[model samples]
Target chain A: MDAPTDQAPALVLGLDVGGTSTRALVATADGVRVGAGRAAGGNPTGLGPARAAAAQADAVGQALSGLDPAAVRYVVLGLAGGAALPSGEDMPAGEAFARVWERAGLSCPVEYQGDALIAFVAGTDRPEGSLLLSGTGAVAIAVKDRAMAARSDGHGWLLGDRGSGFWLGRQAVVAAMAELDGEGPPTVLTGLVIESLSLGGAVPGTESASVFPEGAAPVPASPASSASASPAGPIAAPIAARDLVTAVMSQPPPNLARLAPLLATACAAGDRVAEGIADRAAAYLAATLSAVRGPAAATPIVLAGSILTNPTPVAARVRTALAERWPDAVVTPALDGAAAAVWLALDRFGRPPSPAVRERLFSVSTAS
Target chain B: MDAPTDQAPALVLGLDVGGTSTRALVATADGVRVGAGRAAGGNPTGLGPARAAAAQADAVGQALSGLDPAAVRYVVLGLAGGAALPSGEDMPAGEAFARVWERAGLSCPVEYQGDALIAFVAGTDRPEGSLLLSGTGAVAIAVKDRAMAARSDGHGWLLGDRGSGFWLGRQAVVAAMAELDGEGPPTVLTGLVIESLSLGGAVPGTESASVFPEGAAPVPASPASSASASPAGPIAAPIAARDLVTAVMSQPPPNLARLAPLLATACAAGDRVAEGIADRAAAYLAATLSAVRGPAAATPIVLAGSILTNPTPVAARVRTALAERWPDAVVTPALDGAAAAVWLALDRFGRPPSPAVRERLFSVSTAS
Candidate 1:
């Protein structure tokens, strides 16, 4: 092992590389940590993993400043895209830390693995734990006796995600549009989507530069003139990440546990046509799990991600479904995923920290 | 025999009822002479079978007014939503006509049959011909001799249509929206959809009551007012019948055989997305046909509806698939559906007319 550059015994650094967000946590080894410090940003893999990993390093390094650099002993980096060689061999994750460590003049030996692996570790700390992550992107990972197994349901949001925040958000948008056209079952999200887009501007013609920039260049001659011609909606304008959240939130039924209230208020008063999005969503997640782990892989499946943490009814439905599938497996509630990242990293290094250290590292109070 | 309502040669009247339009035609006893008349408004059950029959009677009455009422011996009405009875029994479709004819103030003998029955008759005139209809709605009808022997599918637009004009058009809209959100493969249809909506005068703030009455209610007061303030795009609206024609016209490749030049131009510019959509549509239609009548059904299948008449690439693809599947069965070019309706109606009374009357009645110039 490389010489432990950081001497800190209390803090264990956890890195979670997701398709959508890359989160880092510094916490005490024992699972009950508040938060030493946290760093959040877009997934480096999506932004081009190499550059994103470098950016992540900068962010992580900035958060670690003024801390006991020598005290830090173990590092756990879990990647969204598993670090598997093209020929299926194991390889180090997309780590820019070596370069970062050289620049910072600090050396901490970092163990690299897939994000699913650490999520499994963080959720249950058992080899047989199953971890599902539904953040900016979606993925599920399972580990048993050090034998790692995984499956990618879709190519993220572009191709498919089946059941994730982005998937639900996208489906909400589709349901909204379909409802607008009087095609599919009604959804409350239509109003929300319409509102979110209007914040940007009118759609289509208004986003000439952003949408069909190459095609619109010759038509306008002036950049200012081109912008003015576009429509006033997110379709025409650049959409923010928060808008996607809003879109997903506004689609669930009221009784649903995931995020149904958003869909309920609209549907109950009778203006909302949000379909049974959560029901379908729960089914999708269950189906994906069953497909991979033998319809009866009934390990304690840990639900992690904003979707699982949804205050609405989706969680309840998911719990109910899992109960039917894995009656014996316990359904654990979701904590802050970033915090899970931290706890996972600590557990990864083999020295689970004390309770006090965990309390000092986790800052869940400010998370939401 | 019942007294002939018209003094023209003994003939039967066939009517193909649709959501937006209703077409009627006259067919002679030989089962070959078919011609189209006017398109009326309203559906069978929606208007009540009584009212629907009256509308059909009026359309047929005016079209054959010059001929002797006594010459028209039997009237066969192939009505929509008349496939199976409420109890799932195969009942004579005459209930629809009797209800309509009684309301029309005439007691002329009328036989009611499912639209698929006539479509099958128009396809082969044999007892067991397979007829596939790909209109705004879709269904398959197979007949053995005069008996309606079998039928495969008809799920309507909401639950499923599998392959139909409505299905294809709706798919086009979805693909366009997906491409807009960068969620799916891109297609030239995005610009087309946008342009089509713009042409429909879709603007922000003022919800068009004429378009969507359900959502036309005043935008509700909500914290997310910003998202709902904007009006939906016209393209995002439920596809209209005319749009279906445009969507159909925009498919088929190589020589641009079926689609408009603009669509062809976009596809030629290396638009794999649009190509994928077109290819999928072709596959869907072929699959639907196979599902209804097995790949090796004994009857020579008739590809009815507008999708077949035009020399579009999608249609060609459907033909190719059918040929590949059957190898031995004959796939006839689509006959004008309304014309087939006319022939079916004439044949129902066992009063087939000469080919001259068929040509004149089915002439496109006589549509108005």
Candidate 2:
């Protein structure tokens, strides 16, 4: 007799939407990936949620095009701008996603959640585990009984997104400008931006008040010298630090994440400005984790997202800060987050995901 | 009976060089105005001390053309970038002023010092007093025995410069964006900036990325959906916030003085962002005063400048911060800092300026 063989598990599409990029994966019922796709994520706040949902649905359909619609049992979307529940519309994000799926003509169950929930599930599928995320935006979420029962801090990128990529980017720009004005020491990035942007000595083609609103009839450019001399330039003259921060957060993949470690290193090297920013970022993350863990004595906390990939420096700093509040807690990294989302979706129906399904989800991606 | 027998004192020209504007006043021996003039203040770091000095010379020549150059017995300049003692050929800011006067072909004894010193002398021409400045830049100075010394906490708007116009502007922008992103509460200033700049969208201009360093330049009139947004627009995106602050600071002189109270009221009304900024600004001023008054604890500190002009909330907060450090020290305000520059100059030479000289300095419309 032929050896007993496991049937192909049902496939589920898991999509993670960030400020800079949108990522999607098709995994078996247990979390083994069978297909994948990628696309640019639109700003739901700027672009209505229906449009965002449609775009996301399109991305999912594109990723799962070759597969039969019936084989794809469910779809889960974790998006960035799902926080603002539309007024007079309960389950607005879900409705938006449902509409998108309907438009795509995909006969599959669709679920929508705040991007933080997926990051939390991705990092800690286990009940009673916490996750801290510091991507373009920052948030800490706690899972209990396989549900998002608790959450701490995701107040956009302004008042707090502390150690987030957006924070790092803002710090870098401020430092660069300071150096330009002879108020601060030169940084490696300062020369990089100046050289990268060709931002010195009254360059031609400087845009003026045209940077104001989306539209209001462009104001005639003042004198040429007036434009070139102020090379902190365009955005520098338009948005307030507050709006610039929001704009930075609006990015799909957050450029600041790439620069955050550099800021941490500079802080370590005695750049007071960088150091202050780093210290604040770490404090913020720790506070967020503590808040998510609640007042419990021994709640387990899980680190998540691109930031926690390296738990040695920044992660370590966050651990130290969290220790101040929650001393008797375990801080662990997530083994498989997106897989957890797939598993959670399956578990929602009655039967738990089987071993074969788990293996498939655990399988490494071929793209990498 | 002869109009209080007012006569012009021995004239001494007082000059102030800043990043954006240059001011000069010719005063009589007794500290009376003789003439006044102003021109664009050259950036020392950008144009170098030589060019900046030449610009000052030109302004002075134009202001004093009709007056007897020989009759102008003394010249004083309180400059921002001219703090360095004269070195070799490079000519630091201090010596550059002397050279500028010589090159201008003016016949008079010229003296130069920091702007902080001039503010102090103007605030407290008495034997002992102090001055605190929180403008686009910030500094604190103390004078005793007709000699002046000072300390500065922030010239770097990026690293520090806390409590300055720049800091306020930066903070305002950050807060406004937070409010717009639904991450922070609504603020009056947010609406003020949006209306003032005529921006339609809550997220600021669409050119945020144009402000970012290494991206495709923003396409003009590409509508909100355009992907080729501006790369240099990020830096100026906060312009609205900065503009709001600039409006507060640059309020038509007489009305501008009233903004301090409004700012303080906003802080008191639970505007945490504004309160935080105001507190930091006060701390910055106090720290500078503490640094300058180091080892000379007994001297009274005469507070001067836009930040401490009146008993406004900001000024009160600054006094409170300083009192925390200097428990028993006095803080006095100065009315006319530029005029005090001329008084201090004559005092430096141990010459009692006659009424005619004082009038020339105070009332004359020509530049010193």
lDDT of 1 by residue, A274-328 (tens): 3366677778777656644555666778776666755545566777887887887
lDDT of 2 by residue, A45-147 (tens): 5466766666676666666666654566777666664223121123445567666667655677766666666665555435567778776657777677755
**lDDT per residue (tens digit) for residues B99-205 in model 1:** 55554344456555666665665555455667666655555555566546554445444323445555555555555545433334545554444344332332122
DockQ for every prediction shown: 0.02, 0.04
Q: lDDT tens string, model 2, B1-368?
A: 11121342456677766655677776655555656667776446446777787778776876565665555676767766322212123335656766667765566667666666776665554576666776655555556665554344534442344566555655555566455443455554454334433443322434442322233321222212222223333344443222333343333222322223334544545555567667777776676666657644756677665667755456879878777777777766654545766676677655755555545444533322
| Highest lDDT model number | 2
- lDDT of every model, 2 decimals: 0.50, 0.55
Query: What is chain B's TM-score across the candidates, in the order shown?
Result: 0.66, 0.68
True contacts kept of each: 0.00, 0.05
How large is the interface RMSD of candidate 1? 17.3
